[model samples]
Target: MNVEVIIVLVALVGMLAALIMDKMRPGMILFSVVVLFLCTGILSPKEMLEGFSNKGMITVAMLFLVSEGIRQSGALTQVIKKLLPQEKTSVFKAQIRMLPSIAFISAFLNNTPVVVIFAPIIKRWASSVKLPATYFLIPLSYVTILGGICTLIGTSTNLVVHSMIQEAGLKGFSMFELGKVGVFIAIAGIIYLFLFSSKLLPSDRPETSGNEEEEQNSTLHLVEAVIGPRFPGINKRVGDFNFKRHYGAEIKELRRSGHTYTDLGNIRFREGDTLVVLTDDSFIRTWGESSVFLMLANGKDYEPAGKKKRWFALILLLIMIIGATIGELPAIQRLLPEGIKLDMFFFVSITTVIMAWTKIFPPQKYTKYISWDILITIACAFAISKAMENSGVADLLASYIIGLSHSHGPYVLLAAMFIITNIFTELITNNAAAALSFPLALSISQQLGVSPMPFFVVICMAASASFSTPIGYQTNLIVQGIGNYKFTDFVRIGLPLNIITFLISVFVIPQIWSF
Candidate 1:
């Protein structure tokens, strides 16, 4: 009924509308909501800016730099190569066996890089072993999501939620807290995948029953075409390209930033279109030298120049994680003194600087690895959470939920928070979702007069349980295009997985932590 309450409600509705309609990008939508509410006197200017300076925000930014160091080190490449099943194993069996390795690697390294390394390898393996690449594609995405839930730094969403909780004056979660439940979910999903995965997964790859079959579908030629500014191809229809005569290439797919032009006939080919072709090494070399394609002229194969010390990078990464974990415990934290403490930022910064010293990325290029857009997005999310709290809208929403939850007890409240966070993760980036829900979680805990830790855990899990849609997680979008999957394929596989996560969270959370 109050004007401030009405303003907050209007802002909330606008944010949801923007997410649903895919209007301005997610961070922009949330930033607009915060600015508009602040200018209207719903939230104080200080509240609007509080999120930008939070320790959580800084930690997430630094961890991105750490992720970059690991990526540039060439450590993961060797591990990934070893993960592919050897020649004697059946393709289906190989995928099932590799699930644990895939999930565990994703737990430590960034999932995006893991998939980039594995996609083409799996495609080639599927051909050699006579199996469909599709079987492994969905499982790859699922395992990555499961793995991200296991650690504090596994996903940006976890860091975002951790930051919001600290901003609200609560302790953030431990590294392995979610692992207790997340590992269990992963095991169950992996078992289900192994049992029914081969059947549920489609067989789209070229099936080879014998030598005759091999020759019939003999490997496609690799073609690389450069976009000449004055060429007729620029701004012309893709179907109009004289591929058969001029290039002798079939356009498998075209990537333009985040979008894909899979069905080439309907797409208009523009300059700088990076086409994924299936050609030979000689042609690929020629194309690469001529600037026909920006990258990947050597086909989807790894030809490293030198041997790698995979163990060194792996040990360093583990040391950083272990150091950060031990530093967070009460017993050890007490001895260090007031000024000294281990947060994501400190550990990540130390690790990145050390890695640079070791020439992982040559400190100069380290700046290139950071994703500035994501950092900006995180800072803005903090501002939005503060706006909601000051507007008193979060309080009103919290009270209504509390009254409803009295009958069902804290379990209902925990589940509700988790589901709401998951919905937000699906609708917007995970950082924005965690930001938008922080005030509500804090408000709910206050109304119930309980520790806010359980609610914080809820946000952590929900933000990472983003497997239902491609838009929900960046990893999903990467795999969807690589595998040539339909939208409905994701919906069918992901819906059941989401429901399973929901059910597990509802049952296991209250038992593990106080509600």
Candidate 2:
């Protein structure tokens, strides 16, 4: 009824329209929305800038550096090499090999980067043994969807929901806590891929060039490696990697835990680690035969997969993640002194200091690793969501839903909420979807007199249920563009995947979390 509220509604509509049209970069659109609100006096300039001050926003930023450190250290690169399909000339065999880790890694890392690192590599591998790129690309996106379910930081949608829950005076999930359910879902998905992906995934296009089915595959490689717990490179420098001189393959990227790194030399080596290297196939095959580095893809899980070094980045990553998770626990939160958090800023500073001193990611260049656009988008999203709530739009919708479902039990309420949120996410950014849905989930719980647990789960699942459209989830979009896929391609595969996700979340969430 108020003029300000009306303005907020109109501005939100404009924002959504901009996102759908792909009219401008999402960050730009959100910034414009904040500017419009300020000029119209809808939100004070201070309020518009509040998102930048958010601990959650900073935490997201730190995650990027953490990811960067892992990559530079050559951790993820080994993991990719070991997991890819063998060049045995069997399409099904390779798909089976690659899908599981692809799915698992996607769950913990930002799916887009995983694809960026894997797509070309996998495509090339596919070509080496005469497999189609189309078959792998779809599965790549699908697995990311499945894996994202397992961790608090596995996807931005999860973090956005966690932040919303905390904002509403509720405790959020712990890191890998969601893995209890997510891993099961991933296992089932990998099974599905193994049994059906080869048959159902399209390979209509051959490996040949320019028959029109060719033209966009084979830009990455699968080099094997393993790091023992006591390599001197654990916190050492890339310049120390004598293997580069010997193996003739560069450590193009690394993975530790869920992060990826491209700054190779600065990364110190570590034990129990793996790497994915990008080199000519002939070089990989020749090296695999010689046994210079233990080839994980060659069946040694714990062998030194790459040249031995003296460094360890995984320990720091584990400390930050575990520390942050425990700190988030209610009892842990109580024990801590006031005003401290395990946030992005906290971890970013901590990780950066370690990496800088080790010359891993020199502090001067550390700034380059952070994805500022994503941070800006996140900050601006906060302002837009705030405006929606302040204007009563979110409350109005929540009230309507409460009336419609008052007679129904929480099961129907939970299912309805998840379904609605899932649909909304498919159309817009998942973080935005969670932000817009949070108030409604909380208000409805208040009206129903039930604990908000079920609603909270719905918000988490709905925000991440990005199965129906590539337009909504960045990971899907990246693969689609790189894979050169048609829009309907996602619709055909994604619709069923969405249904499975919804069914599992709706049934499993209440059972697991006790709504």
Candidate 3:
């Protein structure tokens, strides 16, 4: 490697360390690396800023609002009620009923909101049916992730990869193209969960007293709130923050990773920590929409939109998906204006505007709905990928990979790429994993003189196959805290699913897309 590659590689290692250590917000950590690249003359101003304006990044932002509108409408909550068993049910039966429908919903919408909406409800339902919430919550998060890979709009990572393909002067993934392989993976993964998840997951029941249960049924609510990056009290001692004074809620307990702290003395707050707070009726009304918390577990706290508004929001979402799908057809492309294309960006933008005008979500408070930190992380991820390519680091790494797997052929290379990407995703952000792996995948394909499509598909699958760790995916983190689970719980159950997804992606992707 030359001086530039050495510099980029050093920076890459430091960035990964910072991200793993939680030294700063993921967005800032990624943005810092991009700035380092810019200062070292490895990236231009246009290249540095290009990700901020990427169509994929913008679509993610718009989809956030669309998800928020649907979330506020209470449509998802309504759907969950119907999916759960009315009376007591077995864990296997519950998974059979709930997992597939959730997977389908997640394929159409964002995964975080679906988990945020369904997790608490499912947990509560599990309690009602005398089943362990731990058995259901992890599967809920995993199924959404499985569903997301089924379509272009299923997850932000897919869109990020699609945008990179377009920028590389190739046609991006059409709607449902990923579904060819993704559907099979979803089916196999779900079946595995149905058979083994109940036995593998812990049977710990949520602790509650008669008085606490009565209070829950009354106006007082015990809420589980996940700390967001924007929360001001992060990194400070709980005693110093004065939670009751600021948010008008009492922090009765806090759960971090898998440990529960009821004393709350001298505990420093961290992002993603779940706080079980005792709140009155006005608590959700006051902070439900705030960005301070990633999600509030009390779905019954909010007054959903009117029936007409709820149906309207659902119809609008379908229109956006259908419109974007149809726009990609060759006939529709030919009918469009010379300089214009009716892509996801076009449809999502229009749908967002209509929702705002019609008051699906509050128009004035729209900025709060968007996760700016994630947006920043994604934008910086693109720049980081470009820097790796420009500095020859991607080529250097690709050559080594090809050298190790050449005798075994592309099948081995595909497995190696999947393993590397999946590890990065398990340790850090999924988008960052995709960004880091994309250039390398492209380089490997070019070196082998094969289609890059299978490599790209593998990156998407591996980056999203973050089933083995709670930190790998946001939804996993959400469920981990509420379920009071240990890190080993994920390893025990999720590791098998990880292997299953890996096998499916390696064996099935090449068959469908051709190497």
Whole-model lDDT per candidate:
0.69, 0.66, 0.89
Alpha carbon deviation, residue 422, candidate 2 (Å): 2.2
TM-score of each: 0.83, 0.75, 0.96
The digit string of per-residue lDDT tens for model 1 on 348-447 reads 7788777778775557755545555567778778777776777687899888887877767778888888888889888777877887777888888887
The candidate, 1 or 3, that scores higher on lDDT is: 3
Candidate 1 residues lying further than 4 Å off, grouped into runs, are 205-298, 303-309, 403-406
Instruction: Please give, for residues 222-283, the per-residue lDDT of candidate 2 as tens digits.
Output: 44454422234555676676755655556655654323556666786643245655455466
**Candidate 3's residue-wise lDDT over 1-515, tens digit each?**
68999999999999989988889988999999999999999999999999999999999999999999899888998899889998877888888999999999999899988998888888878778888888899999999999999999999999999999998888899879999999999999999999998889888845431256535567666778998778899889998898999889888888876677887779999877889887787777788788888778764634556898889999999999899899999998998889888888999999999999998989999998998888999999999999999999999999999998856888999999999999999999999999999999999999999999999999999999999998889898888888888889999999999999999999999898888
